[model samples]
Target chain A: MQIFFSPFSPYVRKCLVTAHELGLSDRVQLLPSNANPVTRDQDIIAKNPLGKVPTFITDDGVVLYDSRVICEYLNEMGNGSLLPSGGAARWDALTLQALADGILDGALLARYEDVARPEALRWPEWRAAQLDKAQTSLAHLQAHPALLAPGRVDIGTLTVACALWYLDLRFPDFGWRERFAAVAAWYESFSQRPSLQASWALPPA
Target chain B: MQIFFSPFSPYVRKCLVTAHELGLSDRVQLLPSNANPVTRDQDIIAKNPLGKVPTFITDDGVVLYDSRVICEYLNEMGNGSLLPSGGAARWDALTLQALADGILDGALLARYEDVARPEALRWPEWRAAQLDKAQTSLAHLQAHPALLAPGRVDIGTLTVACALWYLDLRFPDFGWRERFAAVAAWYESFSQRPSLQASWALPPA
Candidate 1:
């Protein structure tokens, strides 16, 4: 399978992390692709009209996308170890993934308000509103530290780690580490996983 | 299940539509709520830190959110008929849902550029960028009208319906109907489904 990806995208990182966890990373190739509002790659857009990264195409040529769906597909294709089969456990993991992905989405929007939009058009109130989502979600994770338990790095946990890592990369001084100690501590340890270390996004140019 | 919702949100409409499909509409009560950048409901925020509507709480006290997860939970809680249980059919439906949901996300962001921001802050290019997502996705759907098959109203189909409906509500001049005749025809007929008509989102106040 080939994944159209940008190392800078949290969503793409989540996909790569999930693949590595499932031991499917070697079976896939990553095509460095920039898919943002400004640099919409036509080839990537052909595969995913959304022009979003984390668009994965199976060997059979079936295209799967949006990190959530791709990760689930990878899990099912492999051992399904990342996500439970049924019951509350399943919902718990899925909801955690949703929360983590929400943080990435919100944080990205906040960053765009600063970097993508023209300086005069940048909206502080909107940026603050978007930042609140990441802060609040981080606090929630801090309250539920059990989600960060070792050996439980499913798609949900991987996504949360990647989202926090993206914040450190893009908004290093956001001060979430001070406000969300437990989550910060969890990140400090989770960052040591081989999958995360191997898939670390390239430093900004 | 109780869903914090605003009638104008396509995502909330999706949850309601999914519940109705699962034959659990009455079992799921809707609580009118506002969750936006400017007006964040603390109650909803506590349930979903993203402060987004369509946050659902099950009777057993489990909170699921962000429409996709909640809809999946409702589908499982009921018969699971609305979503295919496994195999290629399942991934097809899910990928379709991701595509349609992406349309809603982009369109909502564009709408915010106008309604949520001051006139001076309104960025026409940014709004156009967002609308292009909806347009591109809609065109994709139009090319594959099989996705709009009358009997296949799964999560994906339902989400596409809601996204287009939202465009009509918030971006009436988007001219989707004129650009995509097949999609418009499909929408014209699908709009009459009892499930859709019953859960029609109210006109924006």
Candidate 2:
């Protein structure tokens, strides 16, 4: 399998972290692509018309994009180890993953609005609104930090960790750590793991 | 099951349409809620920290939010009637849903930027950027209308309809019909269905 990746994307990082966690890192090869929201790569557009990164082409030529779906497929291929086995636990984990992914989405858009638009065209209100959503989601996660337990190291925890790491990379001034102490501590501990440590190398600013 | 909803939410409309199509509409009651994103609603926030509408409180009292996840749960309850059974088809359906949902997200944020922010604070460039994403996604769907059919009425088709409906509701000036004739035709026909008609009532302006 080959994974189309953008180094600066937290979504791609989540997939990579999942790959490492499931011990399937070597089963897939990563192909770098410069598919931005505005300037989409033709090849990436062909594979994923949405022009988003972390599009995974399977060994048999099956194509999957959207980090959540791809990570779920990878988890299933790895025998459901990264996802909880059944019932409410499974839904909770999936919901948490979705929430974390939502945080990343807001943060990415906030950052994009900052850099992608001209200075006079920048909307502080819009950026603050996105940040508000991110902060609220982060607070929720912090309140439920136990959800990030070792036993609960499902896709949810992995993606949440990745989302925070990206914040550190792009919006270090967001003050997420001071506000979300529990989640911050949880991510700090999780960051030390080999999978995260290896993937910690920052992409270009 | 009780679904907390507002008449105007595309997300809520998606769930309502899914329930009606799956013959589960009668099983899910719609409760009124005023959960505006700008003004936080504690009651709704208790159910979904994100405070988004279309939060489904199951008979078992488990709350599910986010239209995509709620639709998946509804599909599961009806014996996998809406979603594709498995394999590439399933991923394709999901990816399409994600794409359509992406359109909604962009459109919604643009609308919110226009309405909720002061004119001086509103950024036309940022709004244009989001509009561009919505337009691109719509064009892609237009070019690949086959993905809308030749299978069960999956989440993809459902969301594409929702996205078009949203565009019609929010951006009548976008003139998507001129550029994406096929998609506009598809939505026009799809919107005529009884299920869709029932869910088609516009939100408050």
Candidate 3:
């Protein structure tokens, strides 16, 4: 399989982490790629109209994307332990995945509001609004930090960890560790793992 | 199930449409709700830290949000026919659903760029950026109009229909039909269905 990838994308990292966990990392090759509103990479556009990375092309030539879906595909190919087989556990994992992904989305938008747009066109309220969603979500995770434990290092925990790592990369002064003690501790241990260490890159400013 | 909802949200409408299709509509009640940057609805926030609608409360007290997951849960409770059981059909439907949801996300952001932010802060480049995403996605759907057929009215088609309906409701002057005749035709026929009619609402100006 081949993947259009960026080292700094938290979503892409989530996919790579899933691959490592599934023992499929060596089976896939990374083709460094990037896509944005103004300059959509043709390679990504052909694979995913969203023009987003973490786009995967399976050995059989099946294309998949948007991290969550790609991760689920890999989980099935792997131990299938990342997601529960059935019932409430499945929903719990999936919902937590959604929450963490949501925080990442908001945080990315907030960054765009700050640095992507021209100074005169920047909207402080919009930026604040996006950050508020991330903060509220972080607080929720802090309140229930048990989700970050070893046994819970499924898609949800991995995603939450990735989101936190993104906060560190993009908004370091956000002071999440001071506010989310349990979350910070969980992330501290998890960041040292080989897959995360390999995937880490300071996202472009 | 009780769903914290807002009529204007296409995501919320997608959930209602799924309920109707699954014969689960009557079993769920809509508690009208809205949340955003300035005024986050506490009820929504309590259930979903993201504070986005289609926030759902199950009878057993489980909460789910972010449309796709809610739709899956409803599908499982219903005939289980909405999502293909397995294989290529499942991925096709899911990837299509993601694409349509991306269009809705872009359209909503473009609308916010116009009305949610102050006029002086409005960024035409950013607005164009978002609309371009929607347009690229719409062209993809147009090329695959067969996915929008009556026989294909699963989560993907429903989401695409809801997205097209949103463009109609919010950006009447956008004129998607002139460019995507097949998609427009599919949507025109699909829109009159009872499930869609029941879920339709005039979004706030």
Candidate 4:
């Protein structure tokens, strides 16, 4: 198994963390990628038209993409219980995953506005609105402590941890920990998981 | 079930279309929304935090957001086969859905660039790059005809149809029909499904 990878991509990290949790990280090799919104990468685009990182190739030569799809495939392949099989448990976990991904999406857009778009064309309101997604989401998680209960390990929790990881990495001064202390505390403990701590980079050519 | 809706949001349309396919459209009520990237909707944020259209509430009082999770929930509720149980079929359908969603994401970004951003803040290169995602994806579909094979009614094909629908609605002069004849030809027939043809709107107060 292989995944098109970018060291700083939160989506790529989600897949890697998922693999690590499922005990399949050793089997999945990292293939470097230059996925960008404006300056698209043709190499990754050849496999995934989106030209996004974390696109995966199975041992049987099947291609899979987008972090959500890749994570599910890894779960199934490893026979992991990261995703619930059915019922409300399934929906809850999936919805939590969606929320976390939404936060990352907002954060990424804000990051792009700051760095990718030219300064003269940057929109402050757009950037602030994008960051507001994270703010609102953190408040939601802070108020609902059960959503991030201790020792709860699933795609939902893992994804939330990944979102925080990205927040710390990119928006270090966003000060979420001050306003959403419960969520901050949850991340303090939850992010200590070995899977979340594990890092990936492409092997030497 | 109910969904926070915007008439022109393709993600919202994807869920409605999925519900329509599963014969659950009648059961799902549409709630009007002013979901915008710059001006976030507080009502949606109350439930979803993402402040995006297509936030859903089930009969059991469970809330779900983002089209992927809601569509899957509706599928399970209706016992529909839009998503496969497992295996290659499941991955293929999912990846296809991801591709189509990626196209929509790019298209939406481009749309926002055109209308949401101030004229002085617009970046032509960024908008073109966003639209290019659709172009490359269409070329990919044209090459892989089986991905859009006839008689396919799964989420993947349905989403591709939705993407095409949006392209026609928003970028009428894109000329995809002339450029990627195979994809255009496939969509011409596949989109005629009653599910795709159905339109949705908020219920009268």
Candidate 5:
């Protein structure tokens, strides 16, 4: 198995963390990629028209993409219980994953606004609105503490961990910890898992 | 079941279309929303912190969201076969959905640049690069004709159809039909399905 890798992409990190959790990280080789929104990468585009990182290739030569699909494929391959099979557990986990991904989506857009778009054309309201998604999401988690209960790890929590990882990486001074103490407390503990702590890099060419 | 509705959100449309396909549209109520990227909607933010359309509430009071999860939930609720159970078929269907969703993402970004953002703050290069995603994706589909095989109306094909629908609605002059005749031809035939043809609107209050 192989996955196109970009060290900073939260989506790529989500997949790698998922692979690590399932003990399939050793089987999934990382292929360096340059996936960008404005200066799109043709190399990655050749395999995934979206030109996004974390595009996966199975041992049977099948291609899969977008972190959600790749993570589920890894789960199935490893026979892991990261994703519940059915019922409310499945919906709740999937929805939590969506919320986390939504936070990352907003964070990435804000990051792009801050760095990718030219300064003269940047929109402050847009950037703030993007980060507001993370703010609102963290507030939601803080209010509904059961959603992030201690020691509960699954796609939902893992994806949230990845979202928080990106938040800290990009918005160092966003200060979510001060406002969402419960979420901060949950993350402080949950992020210690080996999978969340693990990092990946491309092998020497 | 109820879903937050935005007349023009392709994600919302995807869920409605999925419900229509499963003969569950009648059971799903549409709740009006003004979901926007810049001015977030508090009503939607109350249930879904992401403040996005297609946020769904199940009869059991469970909330589900983002089009992918809602579509899958609708499929399971209606016992539809939009998503395969497992195997390569599932991955392929999902990856195709991801590709179509990616196209929509780029298109939405371009749309926001055109209308949502102020003209003085717009970056032509940013908009062009966003649309380029759709161009490259169409080229990929044109190259791999089998991916959009005739009469195969799973989630993948349905999503690609929705992407095409959005392109026609928003970028009428995108000229995808002229550039990728095979994709255009396939869409012409496939879109005649009742699911794609059905139009959704909030019931008179």
Candidate 6:
């Protein structure tokens, strides 16, 4: 299978981390793509109408976009390690994953506004709103730190780590560490995992 | 199962429409909530940390957010009616759902910037960028009309219809009708369905 990915995307990192965790990294041939959201890539757009990263093409020639779906598909291929079997625990895990992905969405939008728009057109309030959403999500996750346990390393924890990593990358001044000490500590420890350590390497753009 | 939902949210509507179509609506009790993103309600936040609508609290009291997950659970309950069994068709259905959800996210962000942010903080360029994403998504869907055929109303077509309805509510000036005449007609026909009609009410303030 071939995975079309971008270096700087947290979504791609989530997929890579999941693949590594499932011991399926060797099965995926990662192909670099220049499909930035601000600048359209017609070829990538043709494959994925949304033109987003982490587009996985299965060996059977089926294309799948969206990191969450790709991760689920990969998990299915590897004995369903990342997702829980059923019931409340499964729902909580999936919901938590959605929350973390929501944080990434907010952070990405804020970054795009700052970089893609002219200085005069940049809206501080908009950026601040996105930051508020991210902070709110982080606070919730911190209050429930068990959600980040190693045994519970489902899609949610993986995504939460990536979201926090993105915040550190783009908004170092946000001071998330000061306020979200528990989450920060959790990430500090979790980032040491071999799957995370390997996937967390900064892509040289 | 109880579904906490806002009538106006396209995400909520998607879940409700799917439940009704799958004959699972009777199992879900709809609870109303005013959980605006800017002033997210504490109660809703307690139910869903992200404070998004269409949060499904299962019979076992597990809360599920993000329309995709909620719909999947509902489909599973009803013997996997909405989603395809499993194959390339299933991947296409899911990828299409993600694309439609992307359109809704962009449109909502554009609306939030105008309504939630103070007037002086509104950014026309950011709004334009979001509209461009939505338009591009619509154009792609328009070109592939087979994706929205009747009796084939999977998560993808349902979400695309919801996205079109949301655009009509928030961006009537985009003239999507004239440009994407086929999609406009498709949505018009789909919106007349009983399930769509039942879920078509506006969000309460």
| Preferred candidate (lDDT higher): 3 or 4 | 4
lDDT of 1: 0.84
Question: Share of real interface contacts recovered by each model?
Answer: 0.69, 0.26, 0.57, 0.91, 0.93, 0.38
- On residues A1-205, what C-alpha lDDT tens digit does candidate 3 reach at each position? 8788787788888998888877888887887687675566777877777788878887889888678778887887776688776689888888999999988888988888777787898877778778888888878888875666565668888788788888889998999888878878888888777766765443354
Clashes of 4: 0
Q: What is the DockQ score of candidate 5, to 2 decimals?
A: 0.93
Candidate 6 docking category? Answer: acceptable
lDDT of each residue in B1-205, candidate 1, tens digit only: 7888787888888988888877888888777676877666788888888888889999998889778888888898887766788888888899999999999889999989888898888788888888899888888888887878877888888888989889999998889999999999888988888778985433355
- The clash count for each model shown is 0, 1, 0, 0, 0, 0
lDDT of 5 by residue, A32-85 (tens): 888888889888898898888879899998889999999999999999999999
TM-score of chain A of each: 0.93, 0.93, 0.92, 0.99, 0.98, 0.93
Task: Write down the RMSD of candidate 6 (Cα, Å).
Answer: 3.0
How do the residues A87-156 of candidate 1 rate in per-residue lDDT, one tens digit apiece?
9888889989999888888889988888888888888888888888888888888887677776676778
DockQ-best of 4 and 6:
4
Residue-wise lDDT of candidate 6 within B61-123, one digit each (tens)? 777888888998898898865778666677888888988888888788889877876676666
Candidate 5 lDDT over B1-205, as tens digits, reads 9999988889999999999999998999889999999999999999999999979999988899989999999999999889999987899899999999999999999999999999999999989999999999999999998899876778998999999999999999899999999998999898889988899878899
Docking class of 5: high
Model 2: iRMSD? 2.8
TM-scores of all models? 0.95, 0.88, 0.94, 0.99, 0.99, 0.89
- What is the Cα-based lDDT of residue A42 in candidate 4? 97
State candidate 1's TM-score: 0.95
Model 2 residue B121 CA deviation (Å) reads: 3.9
